[model samples]
Target: MIIMRKHHFLLSCIIAITAFTDGSQQHRNTEDVSDYFEQIRHDPSSLSAFLTAMPKGADLHHHFSGAIFGETYWNVLTESNGWMQPYTIEVDTAGALHKAPWIHFATLSRESRFDSLKQAFLRKASIKDYDPSAGPSDQHFFSTFSRFGAVARYDMKTGMQEFKQRALAENVSYIETMLGAPDTAIRLAAGPAWEKSITGASLSDSTTVFNTLDQVYAALLKAGIGNTAKKFCHHQDLLHQQAAIDDSVFMLRYQLHGNRNEQPLTVYRKLLIAFQAASMDSLIVGVNLVSPEDGVISMRDYSLHMLMFAHLHRHFPHIRYSLHAGELAAGMVRPELLRYHISQAVLIAGAQRIGHGVDIAHEAASIPLLEVMRERKVAVEINLSSNEFILHVKNDQHPILFYHSHKVPIVISTDDAGVLRTDLTEQYILLATRYPSIHYNDIKAIVRNSIVYSFLQPDLKERKLGQLDSAFIKFENQVMFH
Candidate 1:
């Protein structure tokens, strides 16, 4: 009995020692990652190269239409034999003419009149040359979408390829972008009756509501929207196969958008179609509210829309949606508008994520609101560059620091890379450079948060997280050991 007790004591000691040793080794590895980021801080070129290779897990707030540059869209149009005549973009205040949009003269005839207006067209097509002196910056940014809309609207296949290829090149493994089937349009005749039926309804009637919406949108699907999305995914599979890239190496999911600037019924129609599309296809993972959040109709009908989301979400329980709440500033919208958007988005609309939660501190119950967000694991999609450009929110003015301080989940994303001319890596750099107190571990936590809060199914998320761990090990070894 004495001998047996002594042996058990020894075994317990051995186990304890092994665990301590293993934990110490893991901590040392994480320390290496921190050390590497700190070392590269002083070397601009090396830092740029290093971050570019960083295996960012996912871009959760990307917009498919805004991901492609104006020049790329122009080229796509030309490739499709689409016609465009040279038209000059004249900002009302300035009669000053700038250089042509064409970066090169190789494509068009030198003698053609269109070549002379190329630069103007380029400026008109994107936020590349947006000058704040001419108009409000947000207006400039949002208008760029419509300017390029004519050409970009023609092809979803091209836009998907654009975002997917860019994400892959940047070592990003997953993308959840805002896109929808172009063929999905609301029936004007059904709008009034449909709105009347769902008005003031509760989640308990989700079945009836969803069924009615499904029937309304069903008439349009056979025309090609369903097949458009199906072909898009199928084509992507074929392309990935052709390139010898495994499907797991690059994954894509979509979030359809509800344009808030439209009428309430129009918004509902879009949301219903978005939910239906998500249900029809596995690739369509989530939905989001888009367009300028500060627009008159958007602000006026904000709560009503939240109620709509609350109702629809109950029916499509599996589908996830994120709100572009608190994307406003002091002057962009009225003082009252900022007080409850982020809070309502979570508490009322049941948003799984919030995009550009810039005005979080201005909420009615700011501290308690933060508490709820932390408790619920609701993430904020941070678009540092875009927020600064559009709303003049940055540094301490931005709620990212507050979110981090309160232990809220946040995933840095490229809101509109092409429009903002920034990528996920640049976002990381901005966060690191701007906030000295932000640690390497915090950045790492958010990377994990991005994948965790993403719309990926539970089992797939687990598998991808394992893959992320492996990729991190390889990446650390390359940069740190060498």
Candidate 2:
């Protein structure tokens, strides 16, 4: 026994020494890279090149539909015989439209005379050449989804391939993208169950609320919601198999998200489905609440949605979810509405991570919330371009620095890379350029947070983190030698 103990201690000491040496070398290489960054900090071209080549660990807040470029959507439209209304740029894939103004993309592309028209359609499909005078930036940004939604429906594998290629090019190894949610049928089926159990119940009564949820949950299960979730998982597996997106260098996971703008019952149903799907599929890592936070239904039922999530958490305690809280700006919603979103998302909904969180400064008990986030290790996803474009909150007004100062974890991400016409590298560039206070090591830690805060399973997360470490070592060495 003594010999075995001595042998174990010796092995532990050797491992510890090796780890210390590697960590010390890593620290030196990071400092060297930081020095290089400082030299080219003010040089846009050099900084862009440096950040582009740097290894970004993961994009934890990506939306797959919004990640495909407008050009790619255009190609899908042309190939699928999709029709586009020239003025509105709205596409129809089902050939259901018989209107005079609806034109086929194939016809439009074939004719030289329609060149300017094609350019206009492309611009309308994305934020390219967006004119603020025409409307609010948020409206213009959100409207692009409908215009290209038809094209997005035709090709899932191709869109995923585009995401993989772009991510690998930028040195991003993992993506936990918001792919989709349960079908309309399953979500609508929840309406009857809600009506039966929760319609007139008092929400203030915790017992009643939980009991109502239990009843609703039982009813949904009787309605074959479990089977529905199984089918969703099976379909996901087929799509993943056909796409073959995962490999040694790149990995893709999904978050089945519920739209916050939907009705309370519908949103709850989606959450149930999302949780169920996540439990069954390893690739489906988590659930999220999406859509514009300031929308009428979203704002009205924001607390209710959080409550539903709290309820679902009880049933599926092991499932993880992130909420899109405080995606709103001051003028976008009423002042009172801004105060408790981040707080509620954290304290009430028990979100593992908070998406956007741009309104942290306005959150009631902001200091406490910040401290709790730091203590609980709840990371905030910083979407610089999206926040700037949608909320007009940028630079000094942005709360990224504030979150950092309070010791709250922050992970930089592209909310909608294709829609914003930006990527993870550009987000880092913006972070480094706009906030010089965030040093190279700080930015590196933020990159690490992307993976660390991700909803990936422990074993898979460890593998990805290992991959990220090697990537950083290689990246820093190149920067130092160069």
Candidate 3:
């Protein structure tokens, strides 16, 4: 049923291998490559130095807000004319809610206030506080978004470049990062009218659901979201152009992120905007659902939200999409909630990829689901650091082995490099150090996996894959014995 194009891939490999070959050593055995990789990893600094320079294909699960460093967030926050003072919520003896706001900078402006609360909030906004002996709860992990939302809200262009620079520093060739609108004021302003106009009952029928989504898309265009989307899309182009000046080798694409915890109508509106944005922009290739997967509102509306995406996909079939499914652990939620998420994401929501996917082992009949994923070629975006920091799953307990064992595709990513205080290279280093079964070949396989499973179109994907293959050949030669 299938024909193997041996020549096509082999031709590229020969071209790559030939560039490094000296007539001899063309068929250097696997042990030579393995030994070279081990020698590189044996160095204490290789994780940051050598691994950083290795050809990383892409980071598919990165979040725009979480990819910026604390210092950058602080700078962006201070760039504002006003100060965003940090606050803590407290309860009194009578159970009355109290807002305790601190200002320790002594009448100092926002920029100077960093000496006081900024560092604390930075720790609060990231895994800086993650301590295995203490705790790394999901609440603490997801709260980082809201903690730094004020800064990331307006820092897209600068943060985009910063992420590109950071990826380049790690030798990553491409990124599929989740980026939100710089300001939601316009989208929100246009929201109420759509909210009042559309009803869930009106979308009960599949045809009606699709037609309603189109109306929402058209209405958003009329309200000028089309212009804003275009502007963001163009800004993405400019960011790419700017980054390419430093290294034309690096590429980035934006995933329109929709908050999943909102009301069905609100979530639908956001999805409509995201789908429309992706449709109108070449730079934005896909849409994704973001928010705490275990949140009450998110749990309540999970199926409804999937239906929304299903309907929207019918109307905007060109846009690629994925879901943040099974980002939970054993005790994080009711057992009933764990069983259906990844299943529904693949079978119902039409997700081409699934992010985190930590609860795979906990799902009912998970083996069958894994088969579905393997058959469908649905890849899991695994973020080891984020998983250990957020879900406390690692080592033997992780389902990575299960996925790998079953031939399920896995692509390692930096879920939130800045927030997690790590990068893609560091994630690869963890894989090498922690998983004994994962050899250098497996590492290269994962790098290739990023491009293979990416939502990027065929032409663009091929371009990046060729770049990756060439880089790999050069990297291999440098690491191997001459």
C-alpha lDDT of candidate 2 relative to the true structure: 0.85
Worst ten in a row by lDDT for model 2: 194-203
- Best candidate per TM-score, number? 2
**lDDT tens digits by residue: candidate 1, 106-125:** 33434465444555656665
Off by over 4 Å in 1: 1-26, 88-116, 181-246
Ranking by TM-score: 2, 1, 3
The candidate scoring highest on lDDT is 2
**TM-score, per-candidate, Cα-based:** 0.82, 0.92, 0.81
lDDT of 3 at 404: 93
Candidate 2 vs 3: which has more lDDT: 2
Candidate 3, residues 1-482: lDDT per residue as tens digits? 12357777778899988876743563363457676677766565865576776888999999988888877776655454334445541101111222325332223343554466666766777777665555546777777777666556554667877877787777887888897633334454445654544433322444554565567666655777666666766776776666553356877787988787776566776677788778877778899999888888788778667777887787888789978999988888888888888887888888999998999987788999999999999999999998987788998888888899998999999899888898888898888877878887888888899999998889988988999887876876776635
Against the reference, the lDDT scores of all candidates come to 0.76, 0.85, 0.75
Q: Model 2, 69-130: lDDT tens per residue?
A: 98888777777777867776567774556567887777777867466766786677678898
